[model samples]
Target: MLYKLNLEHILFLDIETVPESETFEQLDDVKQELWEHKTQYQRKDEFTAEEFYERAGIWAEFGKIICISVGYFTSKGDVRNFRVTTFHGAEAKLLKEFKNLLNSHFSKPNHLLCAHNGKEFDFPYIARRMVIHGINLPYKLDLFGKKPWEVPHLDTMELWKFGDYKHYTSLKLMANVLGIPSPKEDIDGSMVRDVYYNNGDLDRIIKYCELDVITTAQVFLRLRNEELLSDNEIVRI
Candidate 1:
């Protein structure tokens, strides 16, 4: 049934994020205190608040989206292809670009936004960041009283769970188990913050981000028991 869904209507996406500040010391005094309080339960005495601050990208309140990469499938006869694109730079600009894309191209009842673990992370993270930036929420990302079935957002990770919530599986692990090539082979999520803040490598991050979107679409195909994309099928835009 999943494979029967229209591939062109699904916008596959992934995002890369980093702490709002280059360092914890850069946060305002009040924010510093709040960060300490917010992370207390997780950090405990294991590490200082400042030391644990590196992980702030996991929290939308403490981080900003640096890149959002999106991909979609198109077919002509038996030839299938994917086009990947990215929005990067200042958070506001990136958010606006993505919002515009959604409003202009994907704002339809039948279209969907898909990602790996997106419902919990990517989807909500993008929505929250848009709210923070004062940008309009794309219709696809806004839950707003819609029943679960009406939601256009699809999560590959959630599909793989099959109602078993206790077990957690990363995208890389899922890809490995499913025989899909891992996208994060060059740079994993753990290194994103440093690469962005310390090394100032937006190009590298954007490439990695796009790869994630491509891999996510591939994984979704795998879950649907469909054929995986070949290298020639992936076209970066």
Candidate 2:
């Protein structure tokens, strides 16, 4: 089934998120209590709510998307280019822009959205945040009543699983195993919050997010047994 799909019809994406507040104390009393209750099972006496707050970005209700980098394939006359673009800044503003892109270009029924662990993380997180901001769901992100196979989304991690429901793999690990080039040395998801709040380095974070998008595309190609993308084929738009 994978071999039958056209790469041009797919949009590869990755997102970076940070806690709504710089610190747990910065949250209002009500939110503070809610956070504690929300994370009780995950915290389990190992870490306090404040200590676990850094990971709040993993939950859309407690986080805001800072950057969304997307790449799509374009080919003409045997020449192929992977065009990459990013939407960043205010959460609501960026999400609106992203929604426009989805509605305008990838709105077709044949189009698909792909990411690593997207179904579990990226896809639902974007939809939840959009709902919180009162933004209407885009065609691809809105999965209200669609059947399982009718969903126009792809997940590299799920493809790798191939029926091994208990198996899990990180993007970095999958990229390494697939021999896809990865430059994830600087900072990982764990440091994104600190880098954003403490360093105020949105540029660095955007680069990291864009790289993940590129790596995701490459990993998909590897899964399909296609040649990896060359540096010259990637265009940052």
Residue 96 alpha-carbon offset, candidate 1, angstroms:
0.7
Writing each residue's lDDT as its tens digit, candidate 2 over 163-220 gives: 9999999999999999987775588999999999999999999999999999999999
Candidate 1 per-residue lDDT over residues 1-237, each given as its tens digit = 586689999999999988999899999999999999999999999999999999999999999999999999888998899999999988999899999999999999989999999988999999999999888898988899999899998888989999998767888889899999765457889999999988998899999888888889989999988899989999988
Question: What TM-scores do the predictions have?
Answer: 0.97, 0.98
Residue runs of model 1 more than 4 Å from their true location after superposition: none
TM-score of 2: 0.98
Q: Which ten residues in a row have the lowest lDDT in candidate 2?
A: 180-189
* TM match of model 1 to true structure: 0.97
Best by TM-score: 2
The lDDT of each candidate is 0.91, 0.95
Query: Which pairs of residues collide in model 2?
Result: none
